[model samples]
Each structure stands twice: as structure tokens, then as C-alpha cells.
Target chain A: MATPTPTRQRRRGHDPESVLATAVGVFNERGYDGTSMEDLARALGVTKSAIYYHVPGKEQLLSRALDRALDGLFEMVADERASSGAAIERLEWVVRQSVRLLIDRLPYVTLLLRVRGNSGTELAALERRREFDRFISRLVTEAATEGSIRADVDPGLVTRLLFGSVNSITEWYQPARGASADDLADALLKMTFGGLRVDPAA
Target chain B: MATPTPTRQRRRGHDPESVLATAVGVFNERGYDGTSMEDLARALGVTKSAIYYHVPGKEQLLSRALDRALDGLFEMVADERASSGAAIERLEWVVRQSVRLLIDRLPYVTLLLRVRGNSGTELAALERRREFDRFISRLVTEAATEGSIRADVDPGLVTRLLFGSVNSITEWYQPARGASADDLADALLKMTFGGLRVDPAA
Candidate 1:
């Protein structure tokens, strides 16, 4: 028997990575609640039965996709840079790493940010997300306590605004045309950490 | 006929304002694309036909809801404060007003921010949103040109990060328990304009 052609091989290649990537794209575009197995099947160019050859089901796919984002964050939280530095410096490192992670895993992180806890999968993802928020909140509080951060603003509020600017990158960032992740992180850090206004004396 | 009672009047009451507000709530919850006419009707405790009696259709409601947010932004843009001051101060005023508007008309602005341009209504709203963004971009550029803003960072990037933080308020703000608009603006301005770090000499 003759070997399969390249076209046939490419058509049949519904690997786990490709499937997850396609599913994430469809989820981001239509929203997880709006997307169905049929939509995923159509996007994957595979029959519904063939899709079962992938991971178990939509929720499982969602779990994996959310983990792609959550795992990156958890890994960052465990990094030595995040743990060993002065509180303000550690907070800066974490924020920079988060910007890089969000850009590196843009689709997964975007999907994670939009989760509204409508299902078991979404609820679990949200709980994990809240845990991450609490970690950042502590860093902010520690920085405030150390007197590196200004004392006037609430630590909780600081966490929200600082990361809010970071997360908003997902809304408008187009990887092909946008600044590199480092450049984006630098501008964000400078604006939030150093004032945007010009210093007259300097 | 006997006069209608207050409870009966309330039950039957589906005014234009109430209908738009309810539709926006359902849209935000289920997403504009995910929500059906039936969902909006169910949310309002009315039949689908009753919804049509109040408004022409869902798109009309969306257009009105978007206008509610956009009108507030454009009004701020046209104000003397937004136009007459040093560009940096003008930009500051705009940001503060935007935070207040987002809080005041939280649902409508939330809906506006989530628009992805799927339909003609969404497309129109997006165009208006872009126009507002252009107004802001110009303000940032003007501030940079006037040397009131730091020259090293790109004005376009600054505008995005600054407003991105402001717009992110809708994702987590809970009016009943959260900080008042003035306080929220103060924190945001203090962080972005004055910087979050403690000054060494001061």
C-alpha cells in the first residue's frame, strides 16, 4: 500500500495541542457558553465522533485551556524572584512576569479573564483565579507595610488597578502589530511605579 | 374602570428605561450574542411580544444602551475642562470623569466595553468608541508635546494603559460595597499620575 500524502496527513493531524489551540480561539470568539461541540467540530474540520479522539469533552478542554493560563501564574508565584526579593521589588517582578505570561499565552489568559463562573469548570477556574488575586493582594500589602509603596491607597485597590492595567492588554493587544511583551511591561511599570508627569526639578 | 393599584401598576410597568436596563443586564450576563429575545423577556418577567411592544428589537435596545455610555464620554470630551486646560490636566479631568461615568452608568458602560462589533449596532458603537479613543489619544499626544507628560514613554501607550486601568473598574466594581467614585478616582489618579512609590526626599 502507498504511504499517505502530505495533504492527507495534514488533514488528519488533530493533535492535542492543535485541538486545544483551536478550541481556545473558538471559545474566545464566541464565548465558552455560546460555543458548542458542533462549533468545535466545524472549527477542527472533524466529525463530532472524531473529536472524542481528542480529550474527553468540552469541559475537559476548558479545564486544560484554563490550566495553561493558571499554571503559568502559579509557576510565576513559586519563582524565586517572586519570593525572595524586597516586597516592592518582588511585586514589580511579578507584574512584569504577568505581562509576559499573558502575552505568551494570550488566548488562554484572555479566556481565563472572561470566565464568569457559569459552570463547574468556570467556577473552578474562578476559584483558582481568586487565589491568585489573594497572593497579589498580599504582595501589595507587604509592599505598603515595608514603606516602598505609598501608604495613602488601599493595598486591595492598588492590586486591582495595577493588574487591571496589565489584564487590559488582552482586550486590545494584537501580537503581530503590538509592542513586544518586554516593551509593554516597561511602559506599564514606568507609568504605575514612576509618575507619568514630568518632574520640573529633574 | 377602577384605578389600577400600585403593585398591579408595578407588575405591568415595563417602561422604555426599565426595558433597556433589563436588556442590558441580560446582555451583560449571557453576553449580547449569547442572549436571545426570550432571555431578555424572561429577565423582564414579560413575554417576548411585550418586549417588542416597548422597543422595536434587541438591536435598538443595544444602540440606546451604548449611546447612554458614549454620550457621557462625548459630553466630557466637549466640556470646557476637557478642552481648555493644560493638556495633562485636561487628560486628568477626562480620566476622573470617565471613572465616575463608568460607575454612574455601570451596566451600560460595561456593555459598551464588551462590544466586539458583530452586528451593525455593535459596529456603530465601536466606531463611536474609537472616536472617543482618538480624542484621548490626542490629549495624550498634546500633553507629551507640551512636555507636561514624560517624553520617554510613548503617548499612545500611556493613553491605553491609563484608560485600560479606568475601564477595568467595570469588571470588579460593586457599587453597594465598593469605594465611592471620588475615592476610586483619587486612588487611580494618585497611582498613575503621582506614582505608587513613596518619594525618597519628600
Candidate 2:
């Protein structure tokens, strides 16, 4: 017989990724603590035992989902646009790319945003989030030092406001109803940098 | 017999306001759904029946807490400083006052920010929050029209970014460790209005 195609290989129903996606939806809806392993299994139309075969428990699902969001963010920072441009340019690129990531990976980022250190899994996620913020704060500091942005406010404060504005997107953005990601990203870049950058005309 | 003073009347361990404050703490810590009446009573060192005497149930506690937050915000808007200034000035006043309220009632506002419409109480709070936003968005629109702020972005969008930056405060602000509320509010005003206002020098 011919070798099975990748699509045909998973005849059982759900793969690990697909399973995790469903778990994220349930987690976001009912909250992590409110949800149970059985809830995930029920939502996935599978037996609880079947779920255990793929992942240990609910916490693993949360960690994996948040990892996906953090990976996207870290990758954005590592991209050439974020890493090599003039400080302001780089900051703008990071902001724009972040808006794109937030919209594109709404559910995963939503789950990550809602983690409140209620458990070990959540506390670990919060740490990674801080690490990401620290990485970005360095960029803000560099931009300020380079005279591309204002120096009055603390770099760390700028990072908080910038990412806070970006993160708030997951709270209000509905893909079909609001402006497109590109449009919203453009607005974010304008709202943020428009304030941070010195007047070119002056 | 002498009528008991207000303080002496609460010999039953807690009053309605104190009970609600304790409820907000428990609700925020465990989440509204994750928390139970028994959990709340235990936290307050009281019986469930004692809690019920002051409040009907967990939902009432949530509604009461959110109402306190909402009342503070509306009061800020109603203040002469927030209501009578030029559009930009009024907006600034509202922003500064909001930061003060957030800090003054940190736990209450923190609980308010975390509501996700998981229940009727949350949904009602969410609606009131939107009303507050609508009130602010009008100020933004007025500012743009008065040539006080850039009009490139939608007023509603500006409102979201502005409040998003402000609302994110509850996430990371630790009063003792970070900038004072006055200093932070000043920075917020500078960061926001600096980008927004028309450059007089230019």
C-alpha cells in the first residue's frame, strides 16, 4: 500500500495542536480555574483518558498556548526589522508587528493576557511576559538615548504604556467588526510614536 | 438603652461596606466564578449566613463592588474640573482624576477591570464601563474638532488607546515601588497630549 499522506495519518480525530486550540477557547471562556480536564475533554468530544494520552493536564495546555504567544513575540523582536533599524524605526516595527501578532493569534494571546499568577503555570507565564517586557524596554531606552524619542518619561514606563495599548487590543478587537489589523497597527504606531518622537518640523 | 454608635453596631464582625471590600478581595484573588460564598466567609472570618445578612450572595457582592468603582468614575466625570474646561483641558483633568481614583481604590478598580461578563453582574458592570468610555470619547472628539488634538485617528480609537494605557495600570502599578500617582499621571498626560496637541512652536 502507498504510504499514508500526512492528512490521512490523523484519522483519530484531533492532533495535539488542534486539541490545545480547543482547550484555549474553553479556558478563555470559562477561565482556567473554572475549567477542568473533563471540560476540555467534553469540549473536544473526546474521553478524558484520550486527552491524557496527548497531554498531562489543563496546566500543560495553558503553558503551551501561552508559549505560542510568547514565541510569536520573541520572533518579532528577532526579526531584522525589529533588530537592525534606527531605534525609533525599530520600536515602531516592534509595535506594528505586535499588533499584527495580537490580532492573528487572538485566542492564544488572550489566554496569556488573562493569566494572573493563580498557579505555578500562570506564575511562570507571567515571568516570561516580564522578560519580554524587559527586552522591549531596552529598545525604548536606546531610542530615547539616540534622541529619536523623548527622554522625560522612564523607558520602562514607555514600554508598559506601549505594550499595554497593544495588549488591550485583545480586549476590544473583533476581526470582522473593527478596523483591519494593518489599519489598527497603523493607528497604534501613530498614537504611540506620534507622542514619543520629537517634532521633525521643529 | 443607649442607641449603638455605627462602630458599635458592627459588633457582628463586619458591616456591609467592609464585607463588600472583603468580597472584592476574594473575588479578585480567586475570580468571581472560582470563589464561593463559603470561601468569602472564610476569608472574612465570618459565617456564610453572616455574609448573607449584609449581601444576598456572591453576585450581589460583585455588583456592589463594581458599583463603587463606577460611582467613583462617574463622580470624577461630574467634577467641575472634568466638566468645565476646554476639551483638551477637560480630558486632561479626567485622566488625572482617573489615575487618582484607580490608586485610591486600587482593589475595587482592579476587580472592576477583571470582569469578563461571565455573569449578569459582570455584564452589567461592563455596560456601565462602556457608558463611561462613551462620555470620554465625546471629549476626544471635541478636542479634535477644536484643533486641540490630531484628528487622523477615530475618536473611539483614541479613547481606547488612552484608557488602555491608563487601565493597564492596575496590572503592574505598585504604589510603593513605582512613580507617585501625581508623577505617573503627569507622565501619562505628557506622553498622551505631547503626541496629540498641535505644536505651537512649529
Candidate 3:
């Protein structure tokens, strides 16, 4: 039999990356439950099957997006832990890297932030996120012991405060025209570690 | 004709208050969009029309819930601003009141926290929320000028971090066995003012 012509590229019009980006936007707009495959299909002007071809399912799409951000965060932990520096310095380094990562992966990180984990995959992601938190908590504990940080501040509270400050960047930041991620990181760190008290009376 | 007997009084069923409590639960569990009128009705074992009797519509229900929390927050600002205290003291007072308000209105506050303002009502609520934020930011600016806080931190950033820390308490705090809101507030003040770093070296 004559060789059949090779099949046309299936997703030439539909790039997976752009599709995922659209999914994040929809998820961000409507939230997880509020959004559906149909909504995504409508936005893309394509059929559900096309989305299925790009992503196995909605959960997988969520997983993929979260995994990308989680990977960036986890890598920061590993890299910061390896770099040569005192505990506080290392903590500051981690803060800078984290802000950069959060800003760079804004959509993914925004989605990651909203994950409630009613699903098995999401529960796993939450576990991983918690593990990442614990890693930072341990660093704060060690830094406290080294007399690098104030001993009075509860380490757990400190951990939450730091992450909270970092995470708020996701709320107001727009990469289109504003401070770079590193600039934000520096600003956050300077304000946080340094304190807002400009004229401390001895 | 004989007066018609009230069916609700005759039947063993959910009351309006109980239904509202259940609606709040559903709202928190599934979020605003994730929830439906049917979901609330089903969760309460009532018909949708029954809900309408108590709460004209979903928008009214959300408004009632969100308004409760917003009222508590705005009350704090007004109460603190009017209280007998210095600038720093007023700020501290507001912080304490806010934490208490947060715990008292946990579900409503959670819903408030999750709002992305896709709806007109939510957008209005968000605008009011920003007005609250602006009020708090003013306190930060004045407090910094008064030497109540360190000036190294930007007032806007400090405001975000302080509230971020306070709001984060709702995420992990359980009223049964967790630290009281007051304790959380006290811890937040110290952390924000002095930070995690040990300052005795000075």
C-alpha cells in the first residue's frame, strides 16, 4: 500500500504553554471549583478534546502549574542551604531567591497559593508545600540558636510572617511594568529585617 | 375560615439562624463561586425557596456575611483612632482589635480574604477593604514619623506585612486549642517592630 501522508501537526494552533497560561488565568478568575473544562474550552475557542490532548485533566493542569512553582521554591531551599554564608545571611539569600521565584512564576505561584487540596493530588501538593515551610522554620530555629535573630520572636510565627510578606507580593505585583522581582525581594527584605523604625531613640 | 397554622413551627426543621450557619459553612468550604443555592439548601435540608425567605438571594447572603466582618474591622479603626493613646499606642490598639475581630468572624473573614472581586458586590466589598487598608497605612506613616516604628521599612510595605501576619493567623488557628487571638496579636507586634534578628548585639 502507498505510504499515507504523515498526520498534520495536531496542536499547531494550540500551544500547550499558552493553553496552560489560559487555564491559569481562568482558574485565577473563577477559582478551581468555579472553573470547568467547558469554561476553558470556551475561552480557547476549542473543544474539550483539544484541552484533553494538551492536559490530561483539570487536576493535572493544576498539578503541573503547582509543580512548576513548587520546584522553584524547593530549589531555592536546596540552593540556599548549600551556599556559603552565616545563617542570617543565608536566610536573606533565600528570601531574595524566593521573591524572584514567586514573581517569575506569578501565575503558577498564585494558583499554588490557592490550592485547598480536596483532591488526592492536591493533598500531596499541600504536603510538599508544608514540607517546604518546615524547611524554612528549621532555618529560623537554627538562626535563633546562633544568636543571629531575635530569640524572643517565636520561630513558627516568624516563619509565617516571612512567608506571608513574600506571598503578598503575588497579590499586588504586575510584571508588565513595575519593580523587578529582585527589587521587590530587596525591598521586602530591607523593610522586614531592618524594621520600619527610622529613628530609634537609644 | 380558621387561621392557617404555621407549617415551620409544626415541622422539625432547620431554623433561619441554623440555616445561615450552614450557609456560612458551605460558603467557606466551597468558596463563593464554588457554592450554589442548591448546595446550601441541600446542606440544610431545605428548598431553595426556603433560603430565599431568609436571604433574598446569594448576593444578599454574601453581603450579610462579608459585611459582618468588614464592620468589625472598620469598627477597630474608628475605635482605635478615637481611643485615648499616642500614635503608636493607637496602632497597637488597632492591631489587637483586628486580631480579635478576625477570630470572631473567622468564616466571614476567610471569605473576605479569598475574594478576588469578580462580582460587583465583591468588588464593592474589596473597595471598602482597600479603604480600610488605606486607613491602616496612614497609621503606619504617622507612627513612623512619630518615631513609634523604625523608618527603614516603607509604610506601605510595613502595612502589608503587618496585616499579612495578622490575616495568616486565620489559616492555621483553631479556637479550641490554639493561641488566643490576643496572644497572636502581641506576638505580631513584637515581630513586626523588632523582627526575628537578635538586637542585643547593638
Fnat of each candidate: 0.78, 0.32, 0.46
Task: State TM-scores per candidate.
Answer: 0.95, 0.89, 0.88
The worst-scoring run of ten residues by lDDT in candidate 1 chain B lies at B47-56
TM-score of chain B of each: 0.93, 0.87, 0.88
**Candidate 2 runs further than 4 Å off:** A1-11, A53-56, A196-202, B1-13, B54-56, B196-202
TM-score of chain B for predicted candidate 1:
0.93
Q: Which stretches of candidate 1 lie above 4 Å from their native place?
A: A1-12, B1-12
Across residues B166-189, which tens digit of lDDT does each residue of candidate 3 receive? 887777778898777777777676
lDDT of 3 at B50: 75
Q: Candidates 1 and 3: which is better by TM-score? A: 1
| DockQ (model 1, Cα) | 0.81
**lDDT string, candidate 1, B94-162, tens digits:** 999999999999999999999989899999999999899999989989998998878778878888899
lDDT of 1 at A200: 71
Ordered from best to worst DockQ, the candidate numbers read 1, 3, 2
Candidate 3: where are CA atoms >4 Å away? A1-10, A80-84, B1-17, B80-85, B200-202
Top candidate by lDDT: 1
TM-score of 1: 0.95
DockQ of each: 0.81, 0.40, 0.46
